[model samples]
Target: MIGILILAVLAGGCRGGSDSGDSRDSGHRPAGGMMDEGTAGQLPKDGKYDPVITLTYLRPWGPDVKFQEGEDQDNNGHTRWAKDKLGIQLKNLWISPSTNNAFETKLRLSLASDAEMPDIISYRGDFNLVRELIESGKFLDAGELFDQYASDTWKDAVEEDPTVWYPYMQDGKRIGIPILDYAYNSDPVMWIREDWMMKFGFQAPKTLSDLEIIMEAFTNQDPDGNGEKDTYGLTFGFKNWVNTWMSDAGWVFGAYGTMPNQWNLTEEGKLEYGSISPGAKQALEKLQSWMGKGYLAEMAGWYDEAKAVEEFTAGRAGIVVGPHWMPAWPLADVKQKVKGARIRAYPIPSGEDGRAGRHGTSIANGVILINKDMEHPEAFFTYQNYLFDHFANPEVGSEFENGLAGENEEAIADEGDQLTNNAVHTEGYDSEKYTVTFDGARIPSLNMATLLKLAYGGKAVTPFEKKVKSGASREMLEAAEIVMVQRNIAMNQMFTGPPTETMNMNNDILSRMEKDTFSQIIYGKISIDYFDTFVEKWKAAGGDQITREVNEWYRTVNEGQ
Candidate 1:
């Protein structure tokens, strides 16, 4: 229907919503999107679309998204909020379960079959798939459109880290609007069972050799005291690669002054493949030796993140490494598994030179791609700017400072009420703003930045940190404390060069080779010196060409930047 649509949205729990879409309150007034003849052909920055526009969108999450009593994904507070505020109603193009990679997997079928796709899609994971989508010639160039319609608020957000757009830019044309997330979410930390360390009378490790000593102790000291050798010193998944977001092994090389699966700048200012650095050779030899000494879990190579975390949850692994939030899920399960099990967080160990490196992703989460043929490119920007003002970065007295002023306004402020769980209010408000980048979201306030400031500042805890501490087991609190310290010293990779031409064509083959070779060297299937041969083979198989192109792109994107 072209008429306005408004749906009732209920509220949810008192805790901050999911990491994706949290921290939204409410606003007043139904706004406009399009303009009338008296105003010529133009859209209002803060009003509803004059001609109600329905956008076809793909929903990645199924019932995983909480909704109010009368609201579904397609007819919820979020949809109603958009319609009333921007006159942009979202039609559910299709819904796919995000779990187990189902969403992307199904979308790929459409992409390959030339099936009709949605007008707008917000995707995360498998960036290569995103690149494929762009090259499909189905998306619009968003640069000029953005420059013409982006609000000052949205502009400031992008300027915070402009490189976020570099990946979606093709041939100087910005084909995508980047979805941004917290910078520190991907930082690495070492998660060890503090009870085990205390039981063994071992202190936290400071250097690589100290880590080796602790690992040896964890393996042989019977820290679990079950009178059976059923535990491992360390556990992490290496099925995909040696590095990952969680359960990562990249820090091992970082301790030796390198990070595999990244490009590092040489003293000569040339881009050097991290895997070929001398530090990687030493780290691989160390891992091989550790494997021989029975310090590594036997299932490490075969495990994915879910499976890798099981050993730790099941109380068979003493150490796991990942980002600061590990205690929220897989580690949380550990408390249920072992009555006294205490997981604590620490910084990844450093080398003798006191340098450390960790695997990381770019600040951007995903991008918003629009259909090239869509006539309402400016419509998308108008909607996004509205979101930026009201939900993403609401100023106290702005038009959208309050959530959409519809039927639910009375219920939105009732935080104490337990009935409502509508998305306009309950939806992970934080993650979603970024989800619709083209229309538009922010770096949320969560990343523990405030908690860190309070913990180190010696001031009384704020309500948020107090909640972070409430009912938290002493061990969990201590882990959070340690994370506050780790945040300061962690190093993220600076180079995020776009995929080179050679990379786009040969990356699969090359990545497989490197994975196989690296795993072999660590597993003792290949000698340490084989890494040298693998390096040459990789360079010959297009690594060198990719390197040159990547350098050129880096130089270009960063010109005068």
Candidate 2:
């Protein structure tokens, strides 16, 4: 049995695999799941234990993670701090690179063989794998543990959205503790060429009709000089789903009051698939009209998000729909290509009802699981609570104001006046990733709010605000303000659970059909009436059953709330 366990652990280790002795015993107590009453009574109230207990976890690290010389993953500044401050020694049962499915494949091997599990499991990918882990019953009830040991700050963060725990709940028990992230990170804002709009004397678009006028000008006026009607008004990827992270067109469907590629709550108090809603037909008609008028890029049906961005950056397209962070990357490059080019983000234009809707993000980006056979469940929370209380948003001039990597005094002095420099010490070390949660603690609103405030001439009083103000450009701050101003209009996907049995079998076919039909309609290759036929065919092709299963899961989770 020991030989089999060793083989399983070694096979799962895609690179740099290490086993720090047996997971069953860590010299704390008898090899059992929970601490005995006597052991609990003996623990210190200062959030630290005596003699230092080892806490093992299985996780994957990014390939770009770096450490200072002579500081390895298992023996870093974070590990030493945890040991010194919390009396909890952190160890990895096995480590793997995050690329090429290496960590996931390793985890599956361990699960398949029923090998010894770690004290904590840090996972951030695939709700299906989370479901498998829960069903295996090798983990503890994290909700209960959180309630008992979590700090008030941590609990408040989790309670901000109770739905953040939905995907990890099963049979009335919350099996995983959510890793919180910032909200509205992927919410859409219209990114337009300010130069073109100014040249045409167009004001900021407040409604769909107003936007159409600008689109017409961009398409017809040859906004880029030396162009012979070669440019289009807008470009977005449609080869994949219309709703995507970058170069998106979800807001077009949103203008008609339905969002494609997500599940939305209907007025009947049940979840319905958005793609089949009546509003989808109206949105398709508009898209078809745009295609016919040459307002959209030619051959857009074959472009993905990156491909679509090329059209906008190459001065061939004047507008794109994406998140506020565009100014940092591809949008910034546009200035280098076209002289005097100015880009800015604006709130997406509303429909006739004077409301706009775009995709909303879930606050929880990952999950942390605890082992049922672990010796110290509360210790995990003790360590994390410290992270949330101190490192998540440190105060100005505090011990952790510059983060665990420390501050660079030279960088601070050099760019302090401009307030657009990152003064954090990131020279070959990123100790935050070494935390048990993998990315440490985070508050969802701190990042964007800081940028918005800084952009609007707010003073940077706190360390987090100073960090954000130092890094963000004028364009980024302006974009972030627009994002926060329109936060209420974003719509979150209603269904967050793992795929149902029917979905597991039929989703690929349905997704392919949906994408193909939408692309064909936008390209004017098919009649707009064909959308009605597509919707009918979709219901017949397991969409109805998927809806039933989705609503059933929804009711099961929300029961007696």
Candidate 3:
């Protein structure tokens, strides 16, 4: 999980040149205004359509950050292009500079006040906020609207897996649109320092025993060649949920053929909780032994997701486990921190039982919510459908790359253009000759995996893309490509649906039980003999109810699909 924390301020006030035309005619209408039917249907016939409509948005990412004018490739690029090409202006009603607490605070304030709710709320924060928004009854049922008005492309996406709609559905009606991504939602791989491995003459670990040997060597052999045995074997941040632990540690459990926080069907065809299974006990025992040997990070519990990556960046640890995108941002900082440092990624090591599998959390954070009072929900759907067809797919040149320098040469006009900006001229850098040459190329479409690849010398059209592309080395690219290939072997857990009635009501007790049992087992405060006692207490603390509800949801989802 990406740690929900406040980010540092990079730039000051907005720096881009403002649009100076008449404000009223620029498609950005004030709240509570209407567009005529003639204006709604007046899109360009060449498939380059811009419907003039103003929509307010609530974003989890902050407002102060500007979309890179000529070179940035991201969601912000998509939004900006929509304004330029489609005349659909999206204005932020509120922006959370900090992701976790700050985001929650602003959302609550918005809900409490009677101020007009935004046309769209693309939430990517706490699940608790999701539940609150759904219960508020202020949002329109987007599921029903989607079925009625969604484009064929959008419908195909939703129909492929009914579970995609789970986060938005309420009483069988959809209330939000989910932003989709391919791999990061589930699969996690091991990232290693390749330069250190080469120095120490070690290969990437393939099995549990192999991993142990490597970890021991990493700890004792002084892989860094600093002559100081201060380096630890593996490091990860684990604080909030078992899922966070399972995100990285689950690969170890997979060696034993069990996945935590899930219900695995037995040979008898009975669904059983993985955490309570005997396999889990064995996995925990292994982790405990490793902890006892000081192979794992000592302060893992105190660190959050962001800080865990810092360990590897600081050169205090050798291996970090995360999704394929780790090389792009968090892990990419290693080269700056340590001269000539090279990071490589490998598949999760196979377990002791010869089983190498991955456990995936099928659920995403939340879905896009529409204000109940908003009259043009269909327009938003149309806009998103266009985005899906153009940006997400490989067939269309993205709007973000339109009319910019180097775009015509580097971008494949037929295939969707990459989000690399190629503009060399900044606002005031070269004024005289390039005065009217301000290139406003759109950003590229990027998911976590592609971003990682692009970071490591892959070609992209946007200038920002080029910057990141230049940062990564050949070794990094090879490692990222390898991990990308292994993504299919990962197992997406069948049950990531919401909690059942009893479990939801007793969540506090259930959470307490999980924390107490796991902490006690790890600290040796309770013997492994107490495992059975913990199981019984877990059921009493609402585990049993959770199982039944989860199974029911699973059955419903499969049946619908």
Candidate 4:
């Protein structure tokens, strides 16, 4: 990481005249000292400022349009509305019209050129680029900026979990503001075809044995009534790390009280790598048996997430394990392919010892990096505060709802002056119709929960709460509700800090070793007895070193908190 940082800085500084005279000083300070009653720095009572400033941003998408047009900003509804209402113009430095790695190329050119940096950059992808930007020190420290300019609501959110700053932290300062997702992420659950289960006269599975029986039935019973055994029992893709554990068979290890790839604290207070645990071996044995018996998908290792879901939608597979949002995309396609296809989500099945657990990851994804030379670092917080308030109180006529009354109504108003609505519609309804409407002011990527609730028929005070309470026929909501009910049984990873020294050193070897071992065992190329050899190889390949470093990180994180 340090070497990478140095390279990025050298690359940035090599460009000439990129720095303007108004660029931020090496040291930052409050805009106008402490605000007093007479000071202009004080927030206006009317929530409006006379000398509004404009900031340019390089973002992933375009201004809001009736139909999306590549990565152009024309489809970005929120950016346009921000310019209109707040008197803040958010100009796009560039837009990429292609999806296949073209946007990343443009961003790379921007970084390598001598042009001045944009006031802000909202990245949707390319982790490597973000790392380079951080290494350059062109981005301001989000922690200090937040403290100086953030509104009360934004401050509270950042304080909710200090780990939110992990991704953007270089040395000790935070270079970016992370995008917050759920409080506890890693709650993967099994999504089963409800219609198939009923057709086969099987009950919802409660234990690992029960799951095996159900899967066997799905594979052999011809629940689709096609009178042929062409369908599979389960579906999953193992192409990426996200799909490997958090989305697919990762929960299988959870049932054995092992969360693979996570640094877990043992009863003895030692940090242990979950993947090399004895329990993980047990879970692998179970998976091996399932594969040999043809209960698992044959293309598990080859399929990406989309392809994996296709098997389910094509009615060739009966079960999939993923996050709560699975229904919104791949699973929802089942409705078009199979009439009366009903999928039901449930907690991961219990193991032989009655242990049921799911792994949890960090809530924040990446950081929002700001240009250090910006005139108003605090303005970013002010913008975020507005979004937060809207998230908290997403009423029909709220400012976030495109200035249209009852447009994104999650619920109807039964009475006046009430904080809640009686019924809610998903975000794109028009006059109780189910047509997909677009909101130029909507921030869907940042507030998916709110969008989902409006798509459903529930209402609450905030987007988070609404997602917790909202119930609709939508598959995603149903899956979320199921996971929410069993959150207590989930095991959140204790070590979510950046990859440690040993981890960085051995990451490639360990990942390949795990994948190969699991694949070989499942495919009957190696016996379950070989599990011990794999463990030994893991330790020899820096697993032991990783364990030590992970513990150290755990100690440091807890000590400071």
Best by lDDT: 2
lDDT agreement with native, every candidate: 0.65, 0.77, 0.58, 0.61
Question: How would you encode candidate 3's per-residue C-alpha lDDT over 423-521 as one tens digit per residue?
Answer: 322322211111110111111113333345453434554433333343344545555555445654455556545556786698787677766776666
lDDT of 1 by residue, 129-208 (tens): 78888889899887776776666556655665677787787777788888766455656678898899888788878887
CA deviation > 4 Å runs, candidate 1: 1-46, 66-71, 99-101, 393-440, 444-448, 457-495
Off by over 4 Å in 3: 1-52, 67-84, 112-115, 184-186, 245-247, 263-271, 361-365, 394-399, 402-481
Model 3 — TM-score against the truth? 0.76
Model 2, 106-170: lDDT tens digits are 89899999999999998888667888898899998999888766665576667667788878887
TM-score, every prediction? 0.82, 0.84, 0.76, 0.78
Look at candidate 3 and tell me the lDDT of residue 324. 56
**Candidate 2 residue runs with Cα over 4 Å from true position:** 1-46, 68-72, 228-230, 292-294, 298-303, 352-355, 407-430, 555-559
* Model 3: how far residue 176 lies from native, Å: 1.7
Number of the candidate with higher TM-score, 1 or 4 = 1
Clash list (residue pairs), candidate 2? 420-470, 421-470
